[model samples]
Structure formats: C-alpha cells, structure tokens
Target chain A: MPKLINKNTVITNPWTVMKASTGPEILQVVPGKNFIVPLQFWKLYQEELNEYDGNIAVWLDSDENPEQISDELHSLPLIALNFPVFSDGRSYTNARELRQKYAFKGEIRAIGDVLRDQLYYMAQCGFDTFEIRHDQEAELCLQAFNDFETGYQSTVAEPVPLFRRR
Target chain B: MYRYDGYDHQMLADRVAQFRDQTNRYIDGKLSEIEFLPLRLQNGLYVQRLAPMLRIAVPYGMLSSTQLRKLAYIANHYDKGYAHFTTRQNIQYNWPALVDVPDLLADLAEVEMHAIQTSGNCIRNTTTDQFAGAAPDELEDSRAYCEIIRQWSSFHPEFAYLPRKFKIAVCGTVDDQAATQVHDIGIYIVKGDNDEIGFRILVGGGLGRTPVIGKEIFDFVEKKHLLTALEAILRVYNREGRRDNKYKARIKILVKETGVEEFKNKVTKEWALIKDSSLTLTDEEIDRCQKFFDAPNYQELSNTPTQLTDKLQSNILFAAWHSQNVKPHKVTGYSIVTVCFKETGVAPGDVTDRQLEQIADLSDEYSFGEIRISHKQNIVMADVRQDQLFELWKALESGAMASNNLGLLTDLICCPGGDFCALANAKSIPIAEAIQRKFDDHEELTNIGEMNLNISGCMNACGHHHVGNIGILGVDKKGEEYYQVSLGGSSKNNASLGKIIGPSFAQEEIPDVVETIVGVYKEKRIGEEKFIDTYNRIGIDPFKEKVYAKAD
Candidate 1:
C-alpha cells in the first residue's frame, strides 16, 4: 500500500484511485473496496454507485469544476483534485472553492503530479491530504510542509492576509 | 522606503532556505530538470543563452542606497561585473552560476531583498511610477498600494501556479510613466466622487505575441476592497485561463474570447463573495504602509535658485542636461534627475558594478539615500536640490552618466536579446547602437525630441515595443534575422499600441530605416510637433512610402 500525507502526517492510503482507462470502456465500480471515481463517472452513475456497499468518493480533473458535486457534498468522505501535471494549477482553485465556497468539510486531497516542492502550497489551498506521486519518497516529502513558516497572503490555513494579521 | 519588519525578514529567510534545499535536491539528481523548471523560475533564475539570469525584484522600483550597494556587491562578487535594469523595473544579472544562486539570494536577503516571484507563471513584481512620491501630478503615492499588492501577491498559494505569468502595474500620477496600460492589470489610483481614494482597474492588457490594451473592468474599487477585488480577478483567471497553449494563456486572451463584459460580470460575481472578507484593508494597515512612503524632509527654497540659474547660464553642457534630464519635483527647490544609462555604445540599461556603487553614493548625497528604477530602464534621483544642479551634473558627467537625452531618439529601451536571451530572434543591442550612432548629433536629437524608440528581440516584448512611439520587433526570416518597424505607440495617459509600418528590414538597414522614418517626421512637423505627434498627425502611410521608396 502506498503512503500518503493526510492532515500533515504520512499514512497508508486506503482509497484506490481509478483513472479513465485507454479506449472508451466505462469504468466498473468494484464492490467492498474504498474507491475514488472520476467526477464525471460518479455523476453519470450516481444511482448505481449508491446501491454499492463500497465507500465511494469523487475526484475532479484539472478542468472539472468542484461545483458539480456541491449538492451532494455531505455524502462523500473525500474530494480529490487532480493536477494532471504539477504546473497545471486549476486544481488549486478547485480545492479552495471546495473548502471556502462550497464549504465541503470532507477531505480535499491533491492527486497526480503531486511532489514535495508543491506540497506546502497545496496544503495552503485547503488540501487536507496529498497523494504523493509514486516516484516521490512520501516520508521525505512530509518535511515540505515546514518549508515556509508564514506567507503574506490569505490561505486556507490562515484566512487573514499578513497585513490584516500584522 | 518600506523597512522590513521581523515577519518580512523571517519570510525571506525561510524562502532562501527553501530554495537552497531545492537547489541541493536538483544537484543530487533527486528532482528532474522538468520538475525544477518552475521552482528555479519562481526564484527568478533563468537559464539564458550565455549563463543563468537572476532577476532581483525591486518592489515598485523603489531602492534604498543600502539595497543598491548590496546589489553592486552582488554584481561584483557573484556574477559578472555588470547588471541590466529590466523594463519591469527589476534588475537582471546575466551571468550567474546556478549553484551559487542560493548564496546570492542569502546575500540579497540580508539587504531585505529576495528574487521571489520575479518570474515564472506567478504574480510578478508589482511596478509603479518611478516618480511615485516625487511627481508633481500624483494623486497619492502609488508605492503604498504597490507594497500592499506586493504583499498580497507574494507566494499567493492558489495564484502561484497560474496558467501564465501575471503582471500588475500601478500609476498614481496623471502621467502613466509605469506603462500600466500594457500590463496584465493596470491600476490607476483615483479619487472617488466623494473624494475617497480608490483605484480604477483595467484588466487583460499585455505585450507579447498579441498586444492588447487593458479594458476598464471597474470604474472605481474602494481602497478597502482592493485585494479582494484583485483576488476575484485572479481566481477567474486561474480557473478559466487558457492552459493548453502557453502563447494564448494570458488574461487578455480570456478577456477577448469571453468578451470584456462577460469577464467583468464573472469577476464582479466573484468579488462580491470575498470583498468584505478579512483581506479587506483596514485604515490602520493602509496608514501603516502609507507612513513608509511619506514625503522626505525638504528644505523649502525657490524652484530655480540663483546658483542654479547662474550655473545654467555659464555652462552650456549643464544647461543642456538640465533642459533635458531634469524635471520639476513636487517639492520646490528639488528636481528629479534621470541618470541616463543610454550612452552611445552601451546596452540601453546595462550598468557596471562600479556604476551601481556610484549611483548608490550619488543617491545618498543628492536624493535622501533613495533611488528609483524607471520602467524605461533608467535611474532617477528623485529629490535632487536645484541649487546643487551644477555639482550633480558635473558628477554625472564625470561618471559618463550625464547624457543630455532623456526622451530623444537615442534614449531607447532595448532588450538583452540574442546576446543573452535564449528566446531572441536577433540581437537588439547592435540595432539600438546603430540607431544611437546615427542620431548622435545632440542638436539634431533635441530637434527630434521626446520620442520613444523601443526594441524587442522577440514577441515577448520585454523592451515594451508595443507602447513605444517607434517600435522594432526582430523576426527570424528563414533562419536569418530581420527587423519589423512600427510607428505611433504611446504609453502615457492615453496609451496606444504601435502599428507595424510595412515589411521587415535586414539588420544592416535598420539604422537607415529609422533615420528615414525620423526624416519624414521632421519634414512633416507643422511646428514643435514631437515624433509621435507628427507620426500620429500624418499617420504611418507617409513614413512607409518614403522608406520603401528610398529602399527601391
């Protein structure tokens, strides 16, 4: 099992992230396992997913708006924001909107293209957990959170900008 | 100038330490070059043609003597013995080792400076009028708001990784010396109907492959709602801006594609949610930032004193310099002296380590230990006493900084193009040099006065060619270099982008083309009309016909 940073601590990730497979075949939801589905897949098969006994969470791609799941937010345990590439930053806005705009209290996890250098900023944008990219050492990446003790702008961690706080 | 408090010091220290670790990781091969690109760029490091260019941020172009001296030391010790002041009011060191950057950053941190957010797909250094505090026509000192924006935009976690690089410029004066109209976000500090200070916000303006003037997004945003409003705009851009193509990723494209009205509506909707949040500025905080930019202690005296008048009458050189380089200061007895960097053979904005130290000393002696870097890539001693004009002129002349051409054709803004930049299509320095040599006669240049000649090596438009009165863009013609000339751009209160005159010219013919264009302006002028005035009055057709006719 791969380890992920959850709420600033490394832990074994229980949820299996299902990416859209090659070709147009629809992804099947396996029973009795924690699974995070793509937002479109989750939305398309919500009734079928509701009948399954497995714990289901929705994941959004960089282009997917978090508002799609706003109506049923309280039911999901986690909402994963995908980076596709670390430089593609739309997911950061998605995470912030999930937390601040939609008031989604469930876990907001950063998935795909996640790296040590971006962990601090990801955390700042209301991402409670990060699924460290498979190539990165998750244990060492834990130290990324402490890279900056403070920032000037308002963040999920600190809602007040530095000027107001000062 | 705003002095660093403990919090500011701590933040910079943490940033330096963070960069040091990132550098070590890269050296150890733990982080791949692809992954390290944004990390290095966010710290203002770029792998250029010759060496790694490190751009150090001078917030709102304000520099204290101490900071200037520190930069001089860095130039002398860390990299080459020279530095280039960029069009964004930041300074770029062209030759610096990638390994030594962390230590260089540490040295800069000691002077309350860092290279953070100077580049990369993040919010860049916020710029303002070089004469923000000293200009006679200023509504209020724009530096305070620039400082405010600087703090808000610095390491803005969500906006840090935007689709493209963002720029914001603030103008407090009636005259737009900062060239705000061409920035991603141009802020004009204005008075509300009730006399409350606020900002007129313009969005989507940029200069690059596609140059577009900013649209007025909001007529007035109250002082308190500034950051929140900016936040809304950034949020809209961050989520919706084009990321598929880097060339079309600027906010301008989004504004254009979405239509300005629709974009404005989106931003307005977003702003309503966050406008009254904790990010809203308190009067105390505003005052706190404002206090740092308060007027310097001025000894009141006559505008042009007896001593200055006598010196101006006695020496023609001093008189010429005063007539061109000096401008009236908001405070009587003081004058704003532009220390020209456009010497005939030199790169427009390049300054030697020795010149940097000399400028620091000069600032301390003549301008209350303060200096400003103009967007035109020149230095300004904003508070020089009029009585000491002769002495200052003599000092500047001795240092070879007293070129009596503040706005003449020779005082051009040319980018460090093919010589240093990896993206350049052609060399801009030689072209700038050729034009400067052609227009070397002081009397002729004075007659062809107050014209902006800007050159960019590529479509990046770092030299601000889009807003220059006369502009040049270097293009790669079948792997060979050619130059495209444009006419009638102005980056003032009424900003306008230049129009391309005609077909491109070979490198050798650029000087003659410029001369022919200037000739047309000189001949067509009714009376005392500037190059831009004449070009605008007669239009580009006359100049285009004459240049091509001469070519045939």
Candidate 2:
C-alpha cells in the first residue's frame, strides 16, 4: 500500500495498480493482466461505461484525437499518458489542455519517463497522481513535488496569480 | 553591476540554504539520485566527466575586484586553481566536490553572487555588452535592464521548469558585441525618432544542434512595457513550447513551426493582458536602476601619449600588442584594453587563480575596480588611462595575459572538449592549440590580420562556432575525431552563421586546411580586405578546391 500525499492531505491511494502477483504494483497495470484500452474500445463500448469499470488505465498516442472519445469516458478512474523523454514537452501541453479546456476531471496520470524532477510540473498540469515506473522510488518522487517553497505563477491548483500574492 | 538589495540578498541566502538542505537530504538517503538531479542542476551544479562543474554567474560579465578575488580564492581553495570564462561571460570551475558545493554557494552569496539559474531549463544570466555603460554610440546602458531582468527571472515560479534553457542578451550600442542575435531573446536598446528609449525585441534565436538567428518581434517596445512584453513572450512559450522532443523544444523551433507572425500575435495577445500590471517598468524605478551605471568621472587627455609613442616606436612587440589588444574608448584619454585569453600553447578562456588576482589588482589600480569578461573569451579593463597603458601592458605581459592575438588567427574561441566535458563528441582544445602553434609568430599573426576562428566540440555550439569568420566543428566518425571547417561567418552588427565548406577532415589536416583558406583569402583579397570580406567576394569555391584537392 502506497501512502498518497495530495495538495494538503496524506491519505491511502484508492487505486489498485495491476501487476504480476509476484512483481511490484508499480510495474503492472492490473494483477496478472495488461489492461490496454484501444481507440475502438471507447467507440464500441460507448454505452457500457459502467459495465467495464475496474482497476484499469487508458493510454493515448500523440496522434490520437481526444475529441473523438465520448464524453462519458472522461469519468474513468485512471488515465496515463506517455512522456517519450525529458525534451518532449508536448505531453505537458496536452495534459494541461485536457484538464483545463476539455475538463477531463478524473485521475489524469503520467506513465513513462515521469522522472522525479517533473513531479511538481506534472502536478501543476492537473495530474493528481503519477504512475511512475517500478525502478523509480515513488517516495523520492513525492518529495520532489514539495521541493520548492514558493511558485511565482498560478496554475490549476492555485488560481491566485503570483503578482497578486503579498 | 547590479548591487543586491535586501530582498535580493535574502532570496539568494534562502536559495543557498535550500540547496544545502537538498544536498543533505540526498546524502542521507531521503532523496534519490533522479529526484535530486534537477534540484542540483537548478543550483548550477553539473556532474561532469572528471568531477562536478559549478558555473558562477558574472552578470553581463561585469565584476568588481572583490568578486574576482573571491572567485580566485574559491578556485584555489576548493578545486583546481583555474577557472574557464564561458561565452556568456560566466566563470565555470571544472573540478568541485559535490559535497562542498553548498559551501561554495554560501561563499558566492557572501559576494552577492550565486549560481542560480546557471543550469537547468530556466532563464539564464542575462548577458549584455561588456562595455555596456562605457561604450560610445550607446543608446542606453543595458546593465540596468539586465539587472531588472535578473531580479524578475530569479527563481521565477512559472519559468523554473521551462521546456529548454532560455538565454537573453541585451546590446545597447550599434555594435552587436554581445552576440545578441543568437540568444533566446535578443533585446537591442535603441532610441526612437522622438528620442524615447525602447527595445527592438527579437525572439527565438539560439545556437545549438540547430543554429537560428532570432526574428524581430517588436520594432519598438516601449521602455515602460519591457518587462510585461517579455513576460508575455515567456508565457506564450511556456504554454505552447514543444516538450515531446528535446531538440524541437527551443523557442526557435516554436517560431519556425508557428511562423514569426503567428508567434508575435500570440505574444501580443498575452502581452495585452499583462502590460498594464505591476511588472510594467515605471520611469522612477528605471531611473533609479540607471543611476548606478552613471558614467565615471573621465579626465580628458591627448589620445597619443608621448611615452606611448616612444614605447611603440622602440618595441615592435608592444606596438603589435597595442594594435591588437586595445580598442578606441569613447573617452579620448581612456582605452578599453582587451586581455586576450587565447595565448599560444594554452587553452582559450582558462585563467589561473594567480592571473585572476593580478587582473583584480590591475582593475583596482587602473580601471576603478571594475573588470569585464568579453564574449570573445577575453577580459576587458574598460577605463584604462592612456598614461597607464604602458604599465598595464607590462604587468599583463608578465602574467602571460598579454597575448598579441586579440582578433587574430590565434585568438580562437575554443570549447573544452573530450578532455573535460562529457557532452563533447571530439576534442576541440587540441585543434585550437594546433592552429595557435602554427600561427605562433607575432609578425605572421599580424600579417594574417583580424581573423576570428571559433571551435566547438559538438553541435551544441557553446563556442559560437556559427558566427565565427572561420569555424571549426569537431565531429566523430567511427570513434575517431574529425574536424569540419566553415567560413564567412560574423557575429558583429551584420551577424550571420557560417557555411560549411564540405566534408570533415582528419585532425592532422586541419592546419593545412586553415592555411589553404587563408591562402585563398590572401590571393583574392584587395587592399587588406579581411578574411570575411575575402570569403564573401571569392565565395567558398577557391578555399574548398584548395582544402579538398589533396583528399581525392
């Protein structure tokens, strides 16, 4: 069980990450299974949203248009996007637009190469949780989020602008 | 130089303490290596091939004698007794223990200096002309704006984690000595027709794997809205810059993709919102900042000193040095003395601790305790009196700083390559040294006349290889070093990136290639035309023919 620290409180992480029974939960999507939802999964099961609900996560390619997905799918429990590398900050924009413009309010998480340095930034972009790799220390990644004492600009979490601050 | 007020001092002190705590936590196993990486990088600590390298910001290359002495002390005490002056006018210590870095930060804070934003993907030290305040034909002193930007960008919350490192440079004079064109944001402080000071803002310029000359965003950005306009530009970049691919993340790439007009519009829209805010510069604040850089009390004397004439007539060496290492200062009696770092048989920009101390002494004795590091990897004492020129030259000569190759072939801007830097693909110092060795004779160098050869280890182009009249770039082929040559580049007012001649050549053949290029220049030149003018006239065909003829 991982202890999750939100913006102001520490609580038990409710989402059960899937993995091989023998390996770390961070390594697998779900127990003994890789729950990958294809583009067609959203289209084919548009009306059966509650039927397929479980401890599963969704992934999207950069080429995939978010507008094509049904509005109902936005209420999913977990969604993780891949960051190819440190230099590719396109996903950051996508993440921000998805949360701010599209209003995808569910648990939007980052999956790949989500290094510790990017935790604070990812959080600012409205990622409530991060599905960091098994090799990475989750506890350390969490600490990186709180590393800076002050931020000069407002984001989704803190709407009061930097200039307005006393 | 921007003096640190109470707020600035407190921020720097807090930053140092924060870094110290982060370092302790990492060592105590509370923070992982991955987690601690950005924290350390933000503090200007980079783990290099040999040891951790810490780059200390000498804002706009201006330093007091006290600051230089502190740097000398740090260089001697903590690491090697040598520091390399970077193209951005920052000083990089090659070998500092990671554990002692916090202490180094503490030491730096004592001198009102810190390594903050020197590394990581943030706005770096805002560079300006080394002769910002003193240069003739100046519209406004650029250091005042540089200081304001420094304060505004210091640990800026929104921009701390930029998609890529951002660099800004301001040039006040007509001459683009700061290489403003290649920065992320290049601001030219110019007076409008109405005699109001404003900036001609250029955005998305940078030198790296992909070299780009910035495009003009604003023809006349008013003095009041400078900060707000800059904020708007940054906001647009923060919101829209490419993060998926590292190579394509620079604002240049954004400008290229979005087109300058569209990018300008986006910035304008963002600016419209923030322009009337607190970030807008007021006349009072601007005037206050400008007061500090008010011109020194210059005494007028004859340009030609009787003693100088005697020295020049008697000593040819002194004459050559004077011709090359000294520039015409705005004041009649004073001259800007360029202390060349490009000495033969020595790595360019590497100044020993002893040399730094001597420089500090010279600055105090001759130039009102102020020294400047030029973009050309040299130091400048901007206010050297005509009468004290001989004494200054004599002292510099004793310290091995009086290299009579200020703008000559030997005055190469060479980067630390495989010998020290981990990012380098091939060694650059050896190539620079080889060329220096070939052109060692003072008379021969003077005859070649006013050449600028810039060498970079890799495509990252830290040496400003793109804008050199003669550029040498080191490339790797099958684990072996090869050098590529380019010509006709210039970073002055008419700035342009170099054009590569052709294929890469073996390391040993670079000197001959350079000679052939010079040979072509000499043969085609009309009445003491420079290498750039010669290259421009004859084009690269003749040089290419001579350089590659022996290859096949």
DockQ of prediction 2 = 0.13
Error of 1 at A56 (Å): 1.0
Chain A accuracy as TM-score for every candidate: 0.91, 0.66
Which CAPRI quality tier does the interface of model 1 achieve?
Answer: high
The Cα RMSD of model 2 versus the native structure comes to 5.5
B91-153 per-residue lDDT for model 2 (tens digits): 999998989999999998999999998998889999989887777778778999998787668
The share of true interface contacts that also appear in candidate 1 amounts to 0.82
Every candidate's DockQ is 0.84, 0.13
Model 1: TM-score for chain B:
0.99
In the range A1-166, model 2's lDDT, one tens digit per residue, is: 4444444444455554332222223233343333535445544444442344444456554435455554655666566556655434545555655665577877776655666666676777677766565555656666767655554444555544343443
Return the top candidate by TM-score: 1
Q: Model 1 over residues B303-409: C-alpha lDDT tens digits?
A: 88999999989999899999999998999899999998999999999999999999899889989999999999999999999999889889888999999899889
- The alpha-carbon lDDT assigned to residue B185 of candidate 2 equals 96
* Model 1 Cα shift for residue B190 (angstroms): 1.0
Model 2 chain A, TM-score vs. native: 0.66
**Top-scoring candidate (DockQ):** 1
Sequence-dependent TM-score of model 1: 0.98
